[model samples]
Target: MADLIKRIQQGERITITNRDAPVADLVPSASGTEQQTLDAIAAIKNARAGTITHAEFVAMHAKGRR
Candidate 1:
């Protein structure tokens, strides 16, 4: 909807509706400068490249709890 786009551009939070039912959100992506978005994306991409065994991941953070 045009109103939704306008609200998003103006940095206003809005709820999207369909068939009179709220479905999704139309909000600003982040509250930071461009560098933050780039850094976050790079971090996510780098993280996605690795595959860790379940035991390794759990041991790394388990703190001997399990």
Candidate 2:
């Protein structure tokens, strides 16, 4: 597991498998200079700007059930 994590930290993506079938991925987390982290945060906020609230999601789901 440590070896896999080291490889990931070195920019390698590792795919976990089950019975020879891919099940999950072991990828490195967001890591870099402070600027990169800030950029990522800004991108996430921008992407979520148009998202609905939890209450709005629930109301939409209820409407769809009707």
Candidate 3:
């Protein structure tokens, strides 16, 4: 069990089997928030360098739906 845990922490995917049938899987947790923050920051940088300012981007987006 300890070895299995160590494998998981080392970023190895593990399949737990019961009587030779797969029962469960262990994998790394995806970093959604970190990835999203990175993506948003990249987009903002690109917009500033490309065709839009931050204020123009906000103005182009919907303020509210009717």
On lDDT, the leading prediction is: 3
TM-score of each: 0.35, 0.45, 0.40
lDDT to native, each model: 0.64, 0.68, 0.69
Predictions: Cα RMSD each: 11.5, 12.4, 11.8
Across 2-66, the per-residue lDDT of candidate 2 in tens digits comes to: 88877886667788899999999877676543555686566557547956677765665574463
Per model, state how many residue pairs clash.
Answer: 0, 0, 0
| lDDT (Cα, tens digit) per residue for candidate 3, span 1-66 | 898877775567888899999999987556744675686687678777886776867754543221
lDDT of 3: 0.69
Global Cα lDDT for candidate 1: 0.64
Residue 5's lDDT in candidate 3: 72
Candidate 1 backbone collisions, by pair: none
* Models sorted by lDDT, best on top: 3, 2, 1
Where's the lowest-lDDT run of ten residues in candidate 3? 57-66
lDDT of 1 by residue, 1-66 (tens): 897777676567898689999998877667543665676565556546655555655654463352
How many clashing pairs in candidate 3?
0
Per-residue error (Å), model 3, residue 19: 1.1
In model 1, how large is the Cα lDDT of residue 13? 82
